[model samples]
Target: MNDLHQKELLLKSILENTRAQTQAIEDDELELLETLITRREGIIRQVDKLDQEMARTTPGTSKEPTGPIKELLRQIITIDDANQELMEKSVQDMGKEVEAVKEELRTIRERRRQGESYVPEYGDYREEGVFFDTRE
Candidate 1:
């Protein structure tokens, strides 16, 4: 029972941290995002271990979670969903930006190719006659 409560508090803290990390993702802070993701993964591992322990302790019947636990779970779910949406949007925006850059590079390359093949308007030079051979 006490262990369960402690685990619940830990879970809540992890959820809050995860939520903050998700917000960091939206801000485009990739370094902080990476650190936060690693921390969240560790917390997830802890949560999984606690869940397994709880399952082992209760074998006959499943116990209903407390009201606060339920609420916390709901909040975590909502935040995770929003985070997923933001991540998807960010990926799409990056893809579009990459394509635009590629197109610009192609255009620049084409212009350079054209410039290399350009011919100036000066007339061609040629020798037509020789005048000094008669004196020899």
Candidate 2:
């Protein structure tokens, strides 16, 4: 296929992958998210190769890529930006959750230690004495 067609296809593929990546993150599908990211990287590489080939073939041409290619690129960037925002929020939220869990664990451990303090070191409880008062 021609370079333009190839680039278009690659861009479209990236767009599709980006959308899927967003979905994967939202769904909490780690494996699928990784796969989508890898696929998108490969598509990006292909696009880069096409750009290099084109530049070599047309040394003095300074015209920018236009039409559907431009539009595709714009859409890709917008979606990617949103995806990045989502990922940042996810990471932040995850950190908060981890902190909360850690705090809970600390609280539990502290309570356990405090509770243990109430017990005898020998692990046995004996009455020191019994006191009874009877009045008639």
User: Best candidate per TM-score, number?
Assistant: 2
| The candidate that achieves the highest lDDT relative to the unseen native structure | 2
Error of 1 at 128 (Å): 17
For 1-136, candidate 2 gives per-residue lDDT tens digits of 8888988988998999999989988887889999999888888888888898999998886658799999999999999999999899899999999999999999999999999999899888777988888887
Native RMSD of candidate 1 (Å): 4.2
lDDT of 2: 0.90
Clashing pairs in 1: none
Q: Give per-model TM-scores.
A: 0.78, 0.86
lDDT (tens digit, per residue) of candidate 1 on 1-136:
5657877887788788877878798789988888888887888788778878878877764566667777888888888888888989999999999999999999999998897677554655666887576774
- For model 1, give the 10-residue run with minimal summed lDDT: 118-127
